[model samples]
Target: AKVVASPIELCQFNGISRRDKTAQQKPMIEVISSTDFQVLSCINQIKQNMFLQFPERRLIQYDCGKLQTLDVLLAQLKREKHRCLIFTQMTKMLDILELFLNYHGYTYVRLDGTTQIVQRQMLMERFNSDEKIFVFILSTRAGGIGVNLTGADTVIFYDSDWNPTMDAQAQDRCHRIGQTKDVHIYRLISKNTVEENILKKANQKRLLGDLTIDGGSFDVNYFKKNNIRDLFDQSSTLEDIVRERNEYQQKLDTSRTTIAVAATKTTTTTTITNSSNPDSNLTLTQYEEALAAVEDETDRRAADELNKEVRNE
Candidate 1:
């Protein structure tokens, strides 16, 4: 039986682009498991859908929608002298935010994947300690990588992420322990499109997480189950399925081996020590082992779908 893959590339985009490539010429499309996607992918797709829907306003400014909302919120926050964290999925979008902040003459700092290792800590410290800096523009993932910005009481998720946990982690950059004032989170969603779909998926995932944590039952995907036989003819024998599965397994094994070797060579050891000392004094070695165990579990879970497909075969 053939499994219909969830195509990563946006579909129903049959219009022609004004270039060598036609709109019909789609990007490399393939179904990736839920683990392969992050919130940023949905953000990019929604941005594409917006421009696709509104072809006339190609030169329109970026801040017309969320920026207006941002202006009103920041104005009030400035009056209260409350610092804020602004996060976007796309770095180019971060550039737009930089422009908006510059237009308003708001002193701000920035952090992204490109920021140098030495400069990141310095930048975070300045944003936290400096009174002049009123805003911090950050890439969603980069902001939460290593630095802590608890000085900001308000967080603006400049865009939506498909994975709800990603946004949640970014929001906590300010709302975590040692935060004094009440924290506020604002997620800017486009009017309608894949973004709204992403929001629905995110909410469902959030509900699932809550249910699991609370000892309740939940379904990951809300779709109805169907039999594998529906995808193939009745004449297709078990041997044919086994051969197809074996060939795919061999290819996957090769890919996995290559990836594992590359990862092993590039992986670096980082130090982690629990300083809270809240009664349990877990040693650095033990902490590292526990972290490794979690990492292993995450890797296995990411590959669980492949394992399940094999078992079905």
Candidate 2:
């Protein structure tokens, strides 16, 4: 299971955490530098730091961005006729993707915060019955957990969630008790940004969850006198433990990135020599070469990510 995000700086990120907001300060400054738009969306001046508002606003266009990542993945899935679950934290993200998927002619069902609890089951049942419905769009927090849709053999996180546990639960929507085929999970992360850091943190949290639940035996200190206090003393408070754990996790993630990059390093560029037409430059072979180069880059990145997953295991 993985956490995914399509980062193209397309959305007005609302209610961002202080740490992440601070990390994106430079990009926000760039946006301010380029445009004359003053943010007016946040009511309280002091509290309105995370969002950028303008008189007229536009998200980064879908092509050549994260949507392109989805296009490639979804195409292969369509060829195999594999059912899919596409999960995102934001309904607005779902709205945009719905448009993209519909334009591509995929039949899909959706569930979000607005869907009533009573109607949720009915929608899931509808999706389950119709094999022709190839996709399910779900808001991760609202409808990801407890809903069983084993029809889909693929689970994709359109964006990462702050809570690692929620992301894991979202994956379980497809990897449920009665699934017959092997499930494939893809987390589409933007390269070289705060989004990458965020995913590292989430994966570390996932590792912690695994350590807590996994393993064969408990430590001797767990049986010591003042057992409850001893437990608290061993790690301090739960909050403190989490804080210390995250502080230690950063070092581990650094090394993991080093290993992943080392193991999956590949050439992503090629020199195309076209001398067929002296007068003009554009040709079918050249166009195909450009597309292949883009695909090669995408595949290289995916392979690198898969290597990371293997190491994580």
Candidate 3:
């Protein structure tokens, strides 16, 4: 019988990104007997499934759909001589990924909170110089900043951070100034799960970033809502999640377009007021044309799928 693996749903937290702190740490034997997956059963199931699928030469069930897609992407990218940087939030998840890499005979280097500061630089240097190393598995926070890994051209977000900027910083590791090849970044988000909601909230925060960059006076409180219960509750169906994502995107796009128009008008007004020349109707007309073009592009994009990222395999 075939086992369909679901993407491991990580716990949602406010402010700091961390694993369940209240979870009791226990021996393997104790954990095995416990039904609490928060401790170790989740990773155990993944390893068990990997062995189950070993004889078939197909690593289809890796206890998560994200890993299945990564399995295919890794194989294809390796053949093309493209190195990869895989980022996940939890170090335990890194351990699970390492197990998968070892089982598949893929050479990799890992860095997380446990790695010594002196050894972290050494590992980075080794991964950068060694063309034989196919992947660099890293915990998102530890490897996210103050590291340059230009050797790899592809990046995969095994799981996204609650804060969008953290994920963005992690992505910049491979897409920085020293990189030559076109960098490709992928974020794996499980559909119809808590991850979908997390992504939506993250996107909203990103939109706030865009607004701040555009010099729009938008209150950060606009995105905040008393919806924590909705985020963790799994009663929402697939259609409900999709609709929410699309509706939210449309609203965000509309707000962006409005902000753009306001900024354009403000700029045009300031220029007209300061300039000695009065025939600045041309400038206003030009701004109107640019705004129209932006609106048209936004409309075109709004018609497309909201969640372009793939769900669990």
Candidate 4:
């Protein structure tokens, strides 16, 4: 007869040790000049440590980085007979990484937003039990929360989201209560890149920004007082062009909409001969249309104001 596991039994089986050193270890900075080199060196070091600690077995981590670094890291991990769980932010990146890893002769599994709910559970089960498969590349946003990656001892942030809470949640995928070993987190931030500046800004905000904002208003004064100009300066290569084009396009569209709405409003108000009986003459659709026109006009004016603000910046 087949056996079914109970929730209480499963909880006991997956419980983490109170004595886990990884829980107590202070987070350290492992800086390197290049993201690629940092990832390579870190993978090698993790494999060496794994060998010393568990020579008869292998362990891996979730990596979210470029295809090149991931390829090199996977090769080294496989050479040491270790398993890996890789994560990426986008499905496009995941597809590219999957192709590259497969091309390089690695046995791996993947889970992304496209994966069905039922299929995700099956994949997770296979990853936990399979001995031959060495890596699981998942989308961080899709697989970062409510997953049991206790099979992994290390977690790598190949890239980071602007929000630090997301990063913390992603890291917790392996650092949870069931983890037995020291959970080593390796965050790869490219020097002088946007990711580094984002990290600095996120650090200044107590390492979490998503929780601090409410109802569209945030503590902008805190960021201003902190003088975080350097954080916003690391704009991407195409940032200026994209920003300029988008701003210009938004202004033009707003202007056209505003003009059309104003014309309609003027025509409606003129057609309404008696102001005292405006409500009687106006249909619900007409009232809604007028309100929409006013709203669109207000939006256009706001956009113009924002354009001035951007110009000053």
Candidate 5:
């Protein structure tokens, strides 16, 4: 009979229990009597089956205790020559992991909220083409959408987001239409941490309400209580702010586009009216265009001034 090791036992085997005398480390292993090992075994078998059936993609959740276990998994993936994407809710945590990976001589690409649009496109291209870059560290909020990352067949959620939908969105980035191989998702949830509790609450809330709020009438107190600032706040977790901000920004962009289109139409109508009705009183379109031109100039000046104020802030 094949012996299946417990998570704690696996951690110990990975050298997670070895400690430095000078630095204090949290107990790397925790006993979970309630954990269903039989179910896990069955699930593992199912995963293997799905891997065969789908042969193109698979999703699996690994609820393990120690980070070292993740290191071990990554090592196995490296040996198998698997390209992977890792999603994190915190940019700070993403940075820390990037640094750790770099120190360990792992070649990876990191993309977060601070990454510019052009830079993001460049990184995506590199990730797709460069076999040397086996890992892509992504901030869930910034790098989650609007990019095709079919090159990677595996996605690891280093931590759970409040909303499972957010996690799904991140995973779909890899498992989308273009992906040819079986994609596997590994969700690492620390056994009894706030991370687990947060997931439960978020999932419950999702069942009650929508996964995210629509464009208008958000609660200001919620932001205050959470210490969230405009989706890009360092203090707020990437999942909490970025999704909402991205949706809002999309709405704003659409509104701006509509306004610009309307303005152009008004200008064209005015030009046509001026040519046709030479001696008649100026048409409404002509008046509207002149008004719009003045408004546009005023808005541009106001935006520049507002930008200066924001820079000072």
Candidate 6:
């Protein structure tokens, strides 16, 4: 199951974190930099003093919700003696994670785009041979392809990729042959962000693939061009998505029940007609009429039941 980790920025501020906000607002300061030299100079001096006191404090936000969630998850996985592979898209994130692991005293091996090809193989071998290594940190694009890390049973996606298949390929590392354990996969998604939409789109793509492979009927326009805009839509919350899914499921269930009842009724009617008149033959038109009648009856009955429930509510 994909576990969404609500990032601290989105959770605490109800928006992007302070650091991100500051970055966005920093560039605008250039426009007014010369106009207020004295005030800017004073502010810069104070900011420098604060930075000196707390070096890289703003750079390394160790107190985020996602990291907090990761800490707890790692602790639990540690207790179970499980080895984990943590994959992130950015190499900079790997640097932060390395510091985090170091702070927590976790024995981990890392691989990213910067690492040499020879070093990559050696690191993989060492991780596979060494039982002391608790975690393997990797850059998703660099570590996603052409390497096997079956030594780890747990995979954590620190961030999602635009192409879902990249994440799937990364997961296939542990799921390869010679793996004895049941692999657990976790995907951390920031709430009310583009990550949520990315996940939904990934799921839709996977569903489309499954349908195509299984010879299921689907609309050709299901992947229409206009639907691409949904990836950037952040207006819908996770709760809204969950509620919509539940409603869709309920409707699907009701539809299945109605179809089943209609089919049974039509079959019974056909059987009775055949039994009552030995010489009677049911034509295709008659069969269609009977099916249509039962479908209408079933729909009416289902609607009445729904109306009664609504009244009771």
Q: Estimate each model's TM-score.
A: 0.50, 0.49, 0.58, 0.47, 0.46, 0.57
- Candidate 1 at residue 58, lDDT? 25
Candidate 3: tens digits of C-alpha lDDT, residues 114-204: 6666898999899989999999998776653457999899999988765687788788888888788999998787877888776766666
Q: What is the lDDT of residue 46 in candidate 1?
A: 91
Query: What alpha-carbon RMSD in Å does predicted model 3 have with respect to the real structure?
Result: 23.5
Query: Which lDDT values do the candidates have, in the order given?
Result: 0.62, 0.64, 0.68, 0.57, 0.62, 0.70
lDDT of 6 by residue, 232-310 (tens): 7888777775676566556656755765566655543211122333343544345334434654443334334433544
Q: Between the candidate structures 4 and 5, which one is better when assessed by lDDT?
A: 5
Q: Candidate 2 — what's its lDDT?
A: 0.64
Model 1 residue 206 lDDT score: 57
Residue-by-residue lDDT tens digits, candidate 2, 1-313: 8955444232334556556766889788888866644444334563544333321112323544678878888999999999999988666777777777767888998887677657889988888888999899987766623588888899998877644776776898788898899999988766554455455545554554443212223221111122212323332333443576677677667745654464466433322233443444444345334434654343334334433544576
Clashes in model 1: which pairs? 39-162
**Runs in model 3 lying further than 4 Å from the true structure:** 1-61, 213-218, 222-225, 233-313
Ranking by TM-score: 3, 6, 1, 2, 4, 5
Error of 2 at 248 (Å): 8.5
Candidate 6 regions with alpha-carbon error over 4 angstroms: 1-63, 213-225, 239-313
Top-TM-score candidate index: 3
How would you encode candidate 1's per-residue C-alpha lDDT over 172-211 as one tens digit per residue? 7787777778988877765544455455545554543443
Could you tally the backbone clashes for each prediction? 1, 0, 0, 2, 5, 0
Q: Which stretches of candidate 5 lie over 4 Å from their true place?
A: 1-65, 206-313
In terms of lDDT, the poorest run of 10 residues in model 5 is 220-229
Pairs clashing within candidate 4: 62-85, 64-158
What is the per-residue lDDT of model 5 for residues 1-313, given as tens digits with 9 covering 90 to 100?
A: 9999987777678766435421333232222433567678889999999776644311211223445666787889999999999988667677667655765667999887667679989999999889899899986656534678988999998887654666776888888787889998887765445565455444443443332322323221121212111223333343643465556556656755665566655543211112332344543345334434653343334334433544576
How displaced is residue 67 in candidate 1, in Å? 1.6
Per-residue alpha-carbon lDDT of model 4 for 149-225, expressed as tens digits?
77766666666754465567677777777667776676666655666666665554442232222122322223331
